[model samples]
Target: MPARDGDEPSFAVAADRSQWRYRPRRAFWRSRIVRAVALVTLLALCALVILALVREQTGTEGFLVGLGLAVLPVPLLMAAFRWLDRVEPGPWKNLLFAFAWGAFAAALVAILANSFAVRWIATATADPGSADDLGATVIAPVVEETAKAAAVLLLFLFRRRDFRSLVDGVVIAGFTATGFAFTENILYLGNAFGEDQDLGDGGIGAVTAGTFFVRVVMSPFAHPLFTVLTGIGFGLAALAPRGKRLRRVLLPVAGLLLSMGVHALWNGSATFGGPLAFYAVYAMFMVPAFGLLTWLAVWSRQRELRTIAGVLPAYAAAGWLSPEEPLALSSMRARRTARAVASRTYGKAGARAVGEYESFATTLAFLRERARRGTVPVPDFAAREQELLHHLWERRATASPALSYAARATGRVWVPPQYLDYGGYNPYKG
Candidate 1:
């Protein structure tokens, strides 16, 4: 064995295989830790919910009534949030946590703070009548919106990779806002029902029922829609060039003020004898505003899709991605089809890798844009960018075999003609 001069080294092959084994073991442990933390957090939130439901003397019937009212609108609202998030899907666990944080932690804190603030303000002003309005309109909107928005801000701080676009931020913020609204509605509904029970057979019950119907049906969008504006600001700020720190701060502040203004106006209009004024204001101002934002969101999403098409040719020529993959990536429908092909050819893991790679590419693009804008600090920018790229490369490497097989089975070899011109081709040339 020692006399073999041209033999390949066995130790090198063994080391390479060992490195591969080490990676999966590390990944397994990391996943286990993440799951453990997620489970613990969820259990704690559930315990809080149980405590909130049981602390009242209303017993099981009362709790059920309250829960019923609270849970009713959740599905519809969740669907709406999902629609908003269609542009860039995020982690479900993070979204759920954001909502729960608002429902439990934010709601509890806001109630306490708003109550204390109203009492202090009322005493100082020597006006008990003003205290009720203070809590409902001024203090409540400011404190509650801020609390709900904090959930999104914390997400950006902790999980930047998960939030690839403004839509992701909006959806996450909307979820938090919805959670706050749901819990608040429950309290209002329960109080109304309880008050009705005390008043006699028909009177209080009818009024409470009417209130619940209006809050649940007509104005379910109130809190979430309002807070989504702030989410837009926060999300945009997060994307701003690191150099424009002032803009980041000011933009979100402006958004918060806008949210407060809308909330205050809504509260003010509700105090009127007729809902006509509220309807009129909503028609004249709020509807138009929301429509404009929706249009902007769609336009922005289209631009992002175009960006992938523009940048991905380089990778296609490098053999990392097929030219056809970029086109498919631009369309959600096509992306789904690609995943189906992957799943059929390989398995769930192949499909999942496709999704992960797509997400990684989107995040990388956002980071690159941020870096170009000087929003990312120069010192750490290169390292972070490289890390993101490396992750994308690794994901592609894992999925390539499956994707190649899938492409062959489907009789579709997606070669990008434009890939030849990616590095240096003059568009002006014939």
Candidate 2:
């Protein structure tokens, strides 16, 4: 029997079509083959470059020593950034790409460009020391920050959906800087180790200890903090109205300039008033800046949750969401409790359902807010809204009851399933 004209693919095909539709997509960039090749190529190049450079400067033994010492702070910095991103986690793929970019591509660009510019200046000026200082204070900061900024820029422009808020930018930037620092530390620590060896010093000598104290303990956050300014700019740009093209353009540039300025100031500190100037700047300026940024990141997460709570009431009115869900989903604790209760009662699938429910519900809130603000594209809104609604509807049977129970147990809100049977106002209901 022959199938009818429209019978082969129904409305499900509509969704499939939308999902596959061409929209200036950069799918080639996302292909596994391309990604794997690119990653291997970049990582190999960077490894070779860093390895040779470190070996040349530090010798094999010093390189090994540096590798050991430099790795101590890497995990802590990575963990801190991951912790800051807990509220609305971006895809790990994005993070991995950012890390790879910083480790290999950005570092490569910074080193090569800085070296060339320094040599050029030294040849022209006939003063190698002054050229080296100028390179550190001006050339290196601009080149390195711009190189690092490429990762954020790519995410901002190509991975727009992944970069919805300020925290996303901060995390991506932090991770990128962390990667760059990891490579840079290997060099610095290796060099310090070689210096100590040459000075006939044994054990953890004065030079090695001093370098570790300065780079690892006192200023591990230096790179991340400088680049965070650039991320902040891109983040603000992401949040701004797209129609305000001027704002969109200016914000990120401003941020990059600020990053460069601060970086130059940090580099020039040694020449300004010696090591005391570095400590003064670090204490009076950098520490406070770091604190303020941390506060801002945490505060932004809370604001995001509040935004979810505020916009979800309409879905409740339309029966897409329960009356209690807005509150339950908003509180991170309640969300966790819901997952736990679901898993306890119905096992892993139940837990997964509840998790997806929470995620879809959050997406719904953000979408509605974007639509209300007239920023959401008209062509995409209806389709995205329908897709999210369908997902929530599918998970509602298992997840809703569990989430509601969790909400009640957590003392956030409650409406027993039995209570609605009465249908009346129930003014006396507890």
Candidate 3:
């Protein structure tokens, strides 16, 4: 049999296929290991630097107290960002990396760079007070924002697949800034605590309590709000077409500059207009800006959901998806209901499969839109479509019933006549 010429081709093909499978697995694992090791080493180095800096500035007791108190807002901020990202939900690893960069690497860079710049200015100017003012108004903002923006820039260049839209940038930036702020709060609060120790029972209310009240309670989101402007730049740059080279390049730069300007204004407020400056900026600028960004994020999410609802019907017509699927996947409430039902019936595995089904379905919808726009290559489109269809097929028996139930419970009909056209319900249209 081995000697036969015709059989040789088949034997060779089988061997090639077998070899290809193991090769990819081996390469994938090797690459993953290398990346993991590199990331760990980098984070470890940053942690050491940041730890030494903080612990040196704040004594052991103050550092401990700061560490205990500084952690209070971390979970709340994390949960808020997580909630915003519930629709697409970037992997936790990306967020963790972003936070680490902000807390350690970014903070370290900011401290060293800012301190060096201020010292240089002091030496040149012969007036330490004015040099300090210049650093706060000019140096701090530019240095700190650029430092925080490193996370966004890294993700934009390296993890392009995950940094999809403006929301992703905002979330990643927010987390990074949050981490930076956490470390910064620890330093400030701890320093204030040290100052309180020198009060000798003279002051009624300690600086530590006042500092915590101002930073942690009143303005916990200050750093995140500043960094998110830069993130928006990165996100929009990602969305820009290849043809718009200037847009892609300039958007991020503009965003970084804007973030720096805002940060500078915030830092210089005390010097520029005294104590009322903070209140004026907070009311006249910060609150309005935050509100606008929140609106934009929510609106953008709605637009994405609408894309799913509108685009997937074509696939349904082609019999690649259940008619109810697009409707179910479009509604976040329905998606949650679907997962709950799957979990209740078929256990955690079923719930996980349903979640995958939803994600794959959303990805498929976006892919189709991209394909129609000629943004994706034909072979890639076909390959991805086939892959997504296969997964949906595998889980359809379990996921379909759950999704159908979700559609029913959530009052999302799979029938025709969409209401997104006018932004109002059209119950009679179906």
Candidate whose lDDT is highest = 2
For residues 145-192, could you state the per-residue lDDT of candidate 1 as single tens digits? 888878888787767657656777678888998888877876777667
Q: Per-residue CA lDDT of candidate 2, range 1-430, in tens?
A: 1121222222341355446332334588787679779767877887688678767878888888888988899889888888777666788988888887887778888878999999999999999999999999999899999999999998898788888888888999998998888778877888888888788988557888888899999999999998999999988888887587898889999999999999998888965569899889989988998899889988988988999889887787766667788888888999999999999999999999999999888887887777776667866776677777767777888988887787788988744555554567655566
Residue pairs clashing, model 1: 241-375, 242-374, 242-375
TM-score computed on alpha carbons, candidate 2: 0.88
Ranking of models by lDDT? 2, 3, 1
Which rank order by TM-score, best down to worst? 2, 3, 1
TM-score of each: 0.76, 0.88, 0.88
Give Cα distance to truth, residue 174, candidate 2, Å: 0.8
lDDT of 2 at 323: 76
Tell me the lDDT of candidate 1: 0.70
Evaluate all candidate structures by whole-model CA lDDT and list the values in order: 0.70, 0.83, 0.82
State the displacement of the C-alpha of residue 421, model 1, in Å, after optimal TM-score superposition: 30
- Across 317-418, the per-residue lDDT of candidate 3 in tens digits comes to 766566787889999999999999999999999999999989888878877776765546677677666666656666777887899889878889744545
